[model samples]
Target: MSGHHGLYRPGSSVLHRLPAQVKLVAALLAVLAVVAAPRHQIWVFGCFAAVVGVLVATAGIPPRLMARRLLIEVPFLGFALLLPFVAQGERTEVLGLPLSIEGLWSAWELIATATVGLSLSVLLASTTSLPEILNGLQRLRLPALLVQIMSFMVRYTDVVAGELRRMRIARESRGFEARDIRQWPIVARGAGTLFVRCFERGERVHLAMLARGYEGRMPMGDASGAPWSAWATGLSLPVLFGLLALTARA
Candidate 1:
């Protein structure tokens, strides 16, 4: 199945060739390493960023596309930017402004960790299709229920969105504009109605799946797991970074 609404860009890069499971696990490890690194070790984050930059370049995704994808970080950036002013700690003056030292460290940590985590996730999505991500989670022995929920969520979110769009178009076509607060109930009721319709559709879909022998699991896909060389190749960066993190603590 094609990716429903994923960021996957087709390519034959080394990342695209690696098994989804390997890439997923390696990305997780990379994010964890970045998160666990000492906040004072700013250089480690730079190293992690460099590694991600290399992957982005190798994947053939344009930098503008990556920068746009990273826009999701804006909300986190706002919160991080607020931390230094609001948090309490030993204060230091920066350009005649008082800032809490601990808060500054916290802000740095938040931005660095969140940026790394989000970038790694974007890398995964850019390289692997949505279905493959679900498959990888299943291979990792993630709870079957959680996996199913995610699978359905990924599959049906578009349906829900389309339903919403249709509803909006219908409403607008009929001159159902909310000109004031008095019309708010109409919008709320429409939203609730949409939910009920979606719920009923989900029930129908579930019954259909059960009719076709869906015995509480999705059919397995290509089981040819990553080769040992792929593991060594895919994990090399994370492992090297892990060692660097360890050495930095020494």
Candidate 2:
């Protein structure tokens, strides 16, 4: 499958060569195990991070790219930080402020689980193309209609983004600066216009597809099954997590 403008980094690493379906399933299972693990097992979460770190290293993904992409978790981190303040429970003094001990634990657990899950997603996206990911979903028997909708979304998101960018450029060319509240109306109008244009374009594209015999289902190309070794290697991370979850308290 062709990689496009996303988190996908083209390379011949083992992870990049692994089957998309295997990676998808492994990531899902790993996340479920992370969720199931006891929050008090901080060492188990450290092991999880180590496993992910090894995968990242094996994949040869740049640390800078991973760090930049992880900025998405900043909002969750913010919420986690707030927990110690708003949560009602036993209190402890930290840096001259009274904070809930339970809230601190909760915050740690929240950040740990979220970071681990998001990191797995980032790894998957970095390793697999969007098309391959969608194909994996289809192979997994995701509802055809939902898969088709997601396929369209994956295909046209860039087109929509490009249109929006061009509209922004047009606005800028006309000396429209949205630096102040007074200019909000202009920005809103531009957004509405962009939506209308994109909607019309989508209609035209749909008609074209219909003319070209686009039935309800998309043609997922012939993808072969993963080898046993590939499955074992891909599943090792989740298997480790499951074992850790089972013995976390011990």
Runs in model 2 with CA error above 4 Å? none
lDDT of 1 by residue, 1-250 (tens): 4574568898899988888889988988877777778888888888888888998999888999999999998987999998999999799999999999999999999998898889889988998877777778887788879988888888888888899989989999999987999999989988999989989998999899999988887765665666899999989867977876776677
Q: Write the per-residue lDDT of candidate 2 for residues 107-202, one digit (tens) a residue.
A: 999999999999999999998988788778877788878888888877788888898999899989998888999999998998899889878988
Taken over the whole model, the C-alpha lDDT of each candidate is: 0.85, 0.89
Determine the C-alpha RMSD for candidate 2 after optimal superposition of all C-alphas: 1.8
Structural similarity to truth (TM-score) of each candidate: 0.90, 0.93
Clashes of each: 0, 0
Prediction 1 global C-alpha lDDT = 0.85
Candidate 1 displacement at residue 95 in angstroms? 2.2
